[model samples]
Target: MDEPLVRWDWIARNWDNGSPLAIRTLLENHVVMAFAPVLFGLLLALPIGLACARWRLLYQPATAVMNIVYAMPSLALFSILLSVTGLTQTTVIIPLTLFSLAVLIPAVVDGMTSVPDHVRQSAVAMGFRPLRRLLQVELPIATPVVLAGVRVATVASISLVSVGALIGQGGLGALFTDGWQRQFYTPIIVGIALIVLLAVGADLVLIALQRLLTPWSRARRSA
Candidate 1:
């Protein structure tokens, strides 16, 4: 006999199985694994990006290095990290953070460079120090582009977290492996739905954040 495409009973049984494989547990794990690298990468990218923006000479080399890191396969990187971190979340996070940097650094540099020359001159004329101008003027103006990069990095990270299952830390990715091993369809379907939902939901939140942070951009567009 052929099996049905989904089994609601299986989903009910495992929804809160009280084990690591439980849906709730994996969902929580997925959220943490997906978001942590983006947060860390953003924090790290800000200063590096600022430096790259200030020193145009550094931008090419920095981006080149980041592109190389980004080109590395996630599974291969995970294997290499295994010997050091031992099947841990750190192995997954480190690579994702590097990947996030590749996308974010360029975004940040472009965003910073996008600042209008006249606007910067006005800030200087207003007696704003370099640091003060960067914080109060340039950064706010750069928010839209930087947030766009963040959205991309975040969604990519969320998708990549599933690959960690091979190393036993894939969060919701475990469901994929489990479904494959057992030839069960429920977990696989559930996992994919959850991942897609997470990506879309996160993107919406970031868009809202961008609007809130850069009301002037909207006003300019509306004009």
Candidate 2:
């Protein structure tokens, strides 16, 4: 019987002998699976969120639907979607995308709504049309908040994508399930650590992006 490798030894060995699928390959696959859904969901949520922000009438209904969808278990949701999407990336992506909407939409609504009323008034007084104002002024001001939500949704999506391992669509999650079945702790522990690190790294990237995109907000706070 092979002896269980210590965590440090496992890392060193992987550098030479390599881990399953090559750690780099697994990492890349993980990124693809995790971020794709987030991007898709954010795109879908943006217009709906903006509409909700503009019209108070849409908020309650939007909130109700998002809440209901968010409440569904990720695995169960994937299972239900499997028949139609059928054991493909679509099954995984669709459910994860829907999950992301629960986070992204509220972020959009809150960020847009939180813009100061005076800001909107100034835009109107400046002869900015509604669409122009939303594109130029409002979204820029709301960017920091929306990005914060994106950061959260990205992290959550990465974690949930692991749940797809049972369906053969798991990226790094395959490591966890394989390790568990074989009683090998190295891959299981390594997979867990990598996922967490990915989440933190993604979050920091978004923070930097927010700062870069919202220079006026930073300048104001600095002043």
Candidate 3:
């Protein structure tokens, strides 16, 4: 592989230098197609996985589907869906969401399972209803672990959105394709660097959010 040529000056210029229209379009598309699916997957999977953990019968089916989809290689998933969905943004969204579910389900399940039974028993003894108990007692204790899973999912989605570029769905991946096609290394390098920045930045933001949401965990850490 003749490594792509990276021109720092050129990359810096393009990093935030595109026409206003282009910059806005990229931001809009990224949020709608890329961010939405991952967030949707998390929302759907968290409840399902938590419920499944408490109810064994649901576990087999949910985990089975997640296992099968997660086992599919990213490239294969893309290729197969591209054939059916015809290389549109939906093709990218579907597979990435599936990938997110696989990761998130396990995380949520593990977090929920780790909650001490004594806590649940106490909640029940206090006459707390099932949903109320889960919301107030179980979920609070599991916050740190569940947020760790979300951190993993957010980073993974950021990287995978690069793959969305192949389908002509715009994002940082556009830079990589442009570089490869034109043999201009700057775009590729810039794309990778920005992607890294996005992931790291997201992780930091999530960590802060997790600390804010799980105040007890933060207090425990300081103790």
Best by TM-score: 1
lDDT of 1 by residue, 1-223 (tens): 4888888998999999899899999998999999999999999999999999999999999999999999999989998989999998899999999999999999999899889999999999999999899999999888899999999999999999999999889999999999999888889999999999999999999988888888878644756
| lDDT for each residue of candidate 2 in 127-215, tens digit (9 for 90 to 100) | 99988998899998888788888998999999988888888778788878878898888888888889999999998898788777887
- Compared with the true structure, model 3 gives a TM-score of 0.85
Which whole-number lDDT from 0 to 100 does residue 59 have in model 2? 89
By TM-score, is 1 or 2 better?
1
Candidate 2 lDDT score at position 82: 88
Who wins the lDDT comparison? 1
For residues 19-91, write the lDDT of model 3, one tens digit per residue. Answer: 5324345545655665666688889888888888979799889989889988987778888888789877788
Tell me the deviation in Å of residue 100 in model 3. 0.5
> In model 1, which regions exceed 4 Å deviation?
219-221
For model 3 the local lDDT of residue 79 reads 86
lDDT of 3: 0.79
- Per-candidate clashes, comma-separated: 0, 0, 1
